[model samples]
Target: MSPWTMPLVSAAVLLLTGAVLVALWLWVNRQSWTDQEKRTLAQLEVVKVASGIALGGGGLFTLYLAARRQRTQEEAQADINADAEARRITELYTKAVQQLGDDKAPVRLGGLYALERLGQQQPDQRQTIVNVLCAYLRMPYTPPPERAARSAKGVHRPLLRNSGRRAGIRRPEGQSPAAGLVDAQQERDVRLTAQRILVAHLKRGGESWGELDINLDGAVLIDFRVSDGLFRAATFRGATFIGDMYFLGIFTGFVSFAGASFVDEANFGGTFRGVTRFSEVFFGGEVAFSGVSFAGYVTSFAGASFAADAIFGETEFVGRTHFRDSAFSGRAGFASAWVGESAIEPGSSWPAGWTVSGEATSRPGRDGHDGQWFRLVRTSSAAPPRPPTARS
Candidate 1:
């Protein structure tokens, strides 16, 4: 009940109780009193009852009003405090983002840490901060000039500079890193730190792992390691890996690497639970997918080029695995690779020149090299004398 209503009701009850008492007294004394005496007793009774009821009711009403006023004041103060806190958080966020564009590497690192703290404190800002870090990584970056000169033609160029043995960061004014003069080693350190931040937070059951998607298109990852990691939907389209790229023991959401280039040896020995696309990707070094499993709805490698040996030993495909129009300059191996029931329909997306020799189980060749796999195995001729093996 409302404060005002309770006091008013109490007053009404008091008045009624006084009236009832007066009536009872009059009825009891009617037989032993004269009319004047009865009138005097009734008048005195009414005065006394009225005074008591007035005082009690007025006191209760006053108390209720006071309490209501105090509560209102407290609520108003709480709102003001909340507004001030929100403004403080906003100011902090703005300052951190501004520091990300500073020329000094140390300042940029500080900004990254500040944003990370903000995300940890505020769950709603975690994904946004992660996106900012990814954006920084995606900025046009290349290896040092000395390393770039050693790379082959059409490779992703390197642009980051190095001051000394220690690393730093350089994000000049504007969005692009083209005009930014970066120390190669220092820039690599900053990028590594940024990657570490994401890795630390994106783990399962982590305090800051939200349902977020990672997009690192056109990023330059020199010698990074994402092995044994768990990620949500992610895309590294058009990204370049300068050194050995290890994707072993990784469990990921829908993944994509369309047009990505791996300069050195690449290992994809992991399990992909969602769609895995690698269309138009170029593998410059030896690629090993041994013991890899693709349970995704669709796994495609259309138009991919393998300049070195491509190994798929013991790889299992639980769903569609496509390799249409793919080129392998070196020997390709798919020995002991199984096609589960979900992907029984073989040769659906194979190259036109390749053929499947076994309907159910493919046997190894005389030298234990050539094995008839489920669908796609590209040999120089229609059926070569000696085909590649698991060890090839």
Candidate 2:
């Protein structure tokens, strides 16, 4: 009931009780009786009032006890239901993980889907499921030789002939090494499926897994792409990216690609809000960072190598930036790039021929577009650095 209405209701009940009491007193006074009878009638009236009060109080107490009991029962039921749900989730998770260990590729794919579905249903378990997938990718794996390489010069070469035996791939007495290659191919497909599952949920919009940290250290990613993703933190240290890589997203926390290798073209256009690293990275194909914003404590590309064109046009560096010991075999460009005045750290190095302009221009601040900004320009016609030696 409303607070205002409750007071009115109580007042009405009080008035009704007063009126009934006054009527009973008047009736008793109007009756002509002796003093003894009058005293007896008064005693009877008192007893009746006391009995009514006792009954009414008892009824209210009973209602209070019943309501409390009902509340307790409901809470108990809710607890039981919650416990059952938790058990069900645990069972499903265990089953899916077991399936992942199956020898058949189809079974492994099914397990990936099962885990994906579980994550969608149970938001709290999403990170755990993602960790499992990353672990699977991190497992030692050697991709099957490309079809072109195997068929080159009309020779049937089995790339995993010796390793397959060591890996315990059972074969018939006269089975050929090609059987092991087929198994490798199957494993590759399973790994690719896991990668797809991760990319599907990491991207922005439709069923996106919000701001999860990803750790794929030393993992091999084939044709990885993170278009429009939001990461809290990520690590890809010593990872290998086969085929093209696309990283168009936002990193709100620390991100590292140190000691990584990109075998194909890499296109990076995103906003890095925390410390970013690319130390000792190798880019076998063209790499571009056009229009990218690095707003972090430090952005390093130290000891990195670019075998093909390295483009950094219109890039913004809002914090300490480093390109020390970096090598570029092909053409390198930094046209119209902006760096904050406080971003240049002592001993920080740029490309051999490139230098920051003497005049500091006004652009937006870190939050806005106007602030003190310096442009990078080519001051000399020096040759680009020689490519680094090939890895062992």
Candidate 3:
């Protein structure tokens, strides 16, 4: 800081102290004051009015000091923010280098999170951020083994939080535990900061770690809906099936699919909204769904593998999808599906679908889908107009 800045800061401190003292004194003097009260002492006639003048002057001086102090504090806050931003930028770059080199997916995810935190003060960095997230989304999501009977044990296996250190937050401004306590509003700010960090880390593809393992007891998270969401490699490995899981364009850092195998089906019925790459994608977890829904595209799976019961009973596909040499096991079901035929597909495929009335015995996967599933159901051109053969 400049010499001038130090002095201004010190002056601000002194003024703040003086203002506080003055406030205390004034409060004390007003202690006995009330609506029906007055200076009724018998010594009033003999009192010196100069004393009152002195008090009033002190008040004016206090006001001046307070105003000056406020100005300095504002300056200090700006300085703090600038310093924080600078340090964060430096850390972000350092982490980014480490992320690129580190073998674990989480570290790279951390780097992505750090970049986002840095971007808070640098909004124009949005495009740069897009690359980071996109890289993750392009990875892969694969399944593993097959289980005779499916259970919910591996339905949800959460990944690690890829949040960086800056996820920490300061208490609400102007809230002093000694004088002003932060209320819900203040705490909310802190809460939101943490949430942003978590969300951002997930976006950067930090959740999928090739070196680590995931274990979700039984969670079929199709929408990436749960934050701090968990998953299981065993379930994914035993995944005979996996229902529609969509990102809807959200950024993701990590999503564990370790030792997870698919038996019946797997589906990404939406758009890959942002960076969501994950390494070590495996499917051995048996999963079953009658239908699935997704609003955005899907992406990312590095070293992810899949095994059994693969079924896509009825799933919708809306964007570009690629499963670069990914594997699947057992009946990769794509029966009675109604996906949007690519604009290039024969225009006669407007599939009207339905949701599974009961827990779908299998997840749906198909070419053109519209978020619906049907059992023992079929579509026809009105049975060939009833063949009007009789001419009745």
Candidate 4:
């Protein structure tokens, strides 16, 4: 049972066996001995039994000491192995980070892959590796302009869009004038690779990092799409989505896109379970929130501007919703949407002539429903004035 119990029992059995052997020898020589010899033989038998027990105990002690030494050596070896592994991970991490600073785009891409492989092999380093990728995307970058075609006269015109400093041609420190120009197209490719590395490990299925928090504040993403994924506490505040952006996933904690700008089609169809904010966000293209559920403490779209058609079809808002001073340049649709426990704050913009039904407010919490429900209804056909396009 206990660790000491077996050893103690074995020691007792060994000592008893030694005593029995000594007694049997004395009994066999009893008839062949005189009275004087009998006395001498009894004394010798006592000494023999004592010596045998002492020897047996000494052997057990030696065995225990050997076992203890072996255990200590194994523990020390394990410690050494652990230290060696830590050093290896540190070396690999340092080398990969250095690779990211290379001037060549191919070298930077290799660094990104190296970091991804490292994260996959070491789960404890995944969050740190993701932060590195996010930091890379946050670096100063200008998207490449559309390729210009040659004129009919066989002359190439100077590209005006994204010209000068915005064209990513700024000189770096200690660089020659001839090598000062940075290739925007090459930098775009490197940034795209970093974004891909983040997304590849965040989705469901093969080698996915489970529900990690992401903070991409002020980062620029190109043609980003995250579908059927789960996240905890994601932040994209002040970030810029250069192309079509899709956030069709689930957020279990705080999510913010405050002051963000979506340049192309922005679609969001997911569930937000914490405080969700889109305050002052600018949507430059068609925006949709089809079948989305906001079940957080607050869902704010205060001062947000939509340049194209905005749709909220079959969407459910289960918390406090704010649309204060939001401007939509195109048609705003709220078809089949439900709002729960939301107050119509002053200066809040809604769909034209939309009214909240009082009867629907009292019907929730009945029939196993969640909260107070508010159904939106249209009372007039007057459309809101369309605002001017936000982009220059």
Candidate 5:
């Protein structure tokens, strides 16, 4: 209560007490005191006592309610502040990535590092965002906190390789190359872009046969998603596939052909490596190759249905290979090529009498021990014992 209210209450109490005293004084001063007046004085005293108890109890209850309401409001405000902070952190992290460069490298790295903190506090949303960001950074692996910490962290570096930098150095739309020279500026831009993203993604981790199709000349590392999407036509000319390259899960709107290849060596064994699928894809342009070689567990067309000719000339498959159940509509020639392997099983049946002619092809070593698998069951005497060379 206010200071004024306290004084007023004191005055009311004093008036009540004085009135009671006056009544008592009058009784004592009276020549005769009635029983009815005595009863009225007793009732007045009981009412005053009850009023004092009720007023004190009501004041205490009101004070408790006010305190509880204040505490609840404070807690609600705290929760709101916490939510705002989380959203701000997430936004800051996204900005750091979008505007990343050498000048902003500090912010970029800080943003990635901050995820470790935010993820600790707000585990759910932070983790989801972290997973996506890590993917963009193209880090090979991203583990959860405890395990990630337990194992040594992989310092993530990014590089771009064989981006459409090959978009140049080719004959112009209506003009042929001036003799045997390339536009030097175009070549430099292409080389620089490749060196940046390539040195990180490829040179560091060393993966294979993968097509990273973003626009050329951006100088953006592999640290971002292909928001504009895959490349139109890629070139790996004079580029070595030291590691098994992969292009299976790619969704390129145009063609991807790796010509002029050094596909397989000791450290470089080409396999399906991972799942390779080119499902229902159309290649308007030809997939030309001059000297592409494959070694190791190689699977070129796995569940792939090609509408164009998989024209392989001077190409070599030196290991367990399969073009199993794949459709090659146009001509498929293994001309002047060699296959030196323990076994070569052909799965594609020629229903259209589709030609798979190898004009000057030679198998390095031929074994007759494979007779159990392909020995003749029906004799065609008219065809002259179906010569063992033909093997009916």
Candidate 6:
């Protein structure tokens, strides 16, 4: 109510009371009541009316202040609770990461699981946990040398040998496997487990994490698979694939494989939905993309080299695919490959030893007239010519 409302109402009530009292006084005066007694009664009534108005207004204002104060206290308590909860989550995350640094493989595995659980429980921590896991995978580790010679192995064996020597010296016995040193087999298992965890979370649906950016630069991976998965961004720059690698993932963001080496066979049967780069990549063994699709705006393979047969049979290039200055050391097959109004320039960068299949070529004969040599033509043609039929 307005400040003047209460005062006005009180004054009206007082006037009515005074009028009634005066009428009573008139009647009483006609009787035996004295004028001084009526005056005393009127003064007492005025004092009571003033006191009631003051008390009622004061009570309402006090209640309003109390209610506001209670609300403020509740908000403050809630803020404090949120802060404490955040602190607790941070502590848990720290403990789990610390466990990953433990020397024992089992302990490290436990730490991975803990981080995984934490990420699942806290959606905000998912990307951080993923980074931690990738960092672990990116760390250097030596697999035991399969051969007697230490340098012949593909895995990191120097770290293992040093660890063993340190353990041997510390042992009370003459020489023994070092304490807290993971053996080659155990180390391999750990690496495989890490790979599995990464792949499992990247799959679609069923607790799978989406829109993750993976950076595995200079990491050593073996028999890796990214089939039927989705990623925000993926980079394997300078990475070494020890065994066969299958890259069939769908990239929604930037992707790179510059300077990456595929030691064994690699199959890039994937779909690119964004910018993609594969410059200076080396495929040591055979590589095939029989049904792959490159649909990104920019797909580059500048300076990439293929040692063995590189097949692109039936591959679809729906976007700009560049292979500028790339070397094909072996047969480069593009039989039945489709370039649907897209840009794909396979220039004359092949090595002298390289030969392209399904190309129509011609060389001069002893005769003055021009003579046809090979049945395929090599040019920067976006649309592939009709593939020659196979001989019976």
lDDT of each: 0.72, 0.83, 0.39, 0.77, 0.37, 0.69
List, in order, the clash count of every candidate structure.
Answer: 10, 6, 135, 0, 11, 7
- Give lDDT for model 3: 0.39
Model 1, residue 229: distance off in Å is 2.3
Q: Which ten residues in a row have the lowest lDDT in candidate 6?
A: 383-392
TM-score of 1: 0.68
Arrange candidates, best TM-score first: 2, 4, 1, 6, 3, 5
Candidate 5 lDDT, tens digit per residue, 1-392?
35685556656655765566566555555635478687677667655655665565456556766887788999999999988997897686666455333233344445444544444455454435434343433322222233333332343324535667554445458533331122222222333333333323322123221343332211212212221122223322222222222331223233222222222211111122222223222222233333333432332443233334444554444444444344444444444434433224463222122223333233332211112111111122122111111000
TM-scores for all candidates: the values are 0.68, 0.82, 0.30, 0.78, 0.29, 0.66
Best candidate, lDDT-wise?
2
Candidate 6: Cα lDDT at 279? 85
Q: In model 6, how large is the Cα lDDT of residue 194?
A: 78
> Which candidate leads in TM-score?
2
lDDT of 3 by residue, 217-258 (tens): 232322232233322111232221244343222222233343
Q: Point out the worst 10-residue segment of candidate 4 by lDDT.
A: 148-157
Better of 2 and 5 by lDDT: 2
At residue 333, give the lDDT of candidate 1: 78
Model 4 TM-score, 2 decimals: 0.78
RMSD of each: 10.3, 7.8, 22.9, 7.8, 19.8, 12.8
Candidate 2 structure, TM-score to reference: 0.82
lDDT of 1 by residue, 205-312 (tens): 645465577889899887657655667788999998888877754555889999898888998866787899988888888998887878787888888888888888
Give a tens-digit lDDT track for model 2, residues 267-314.
Answer: 998799999999999999999998889988899998898888998988
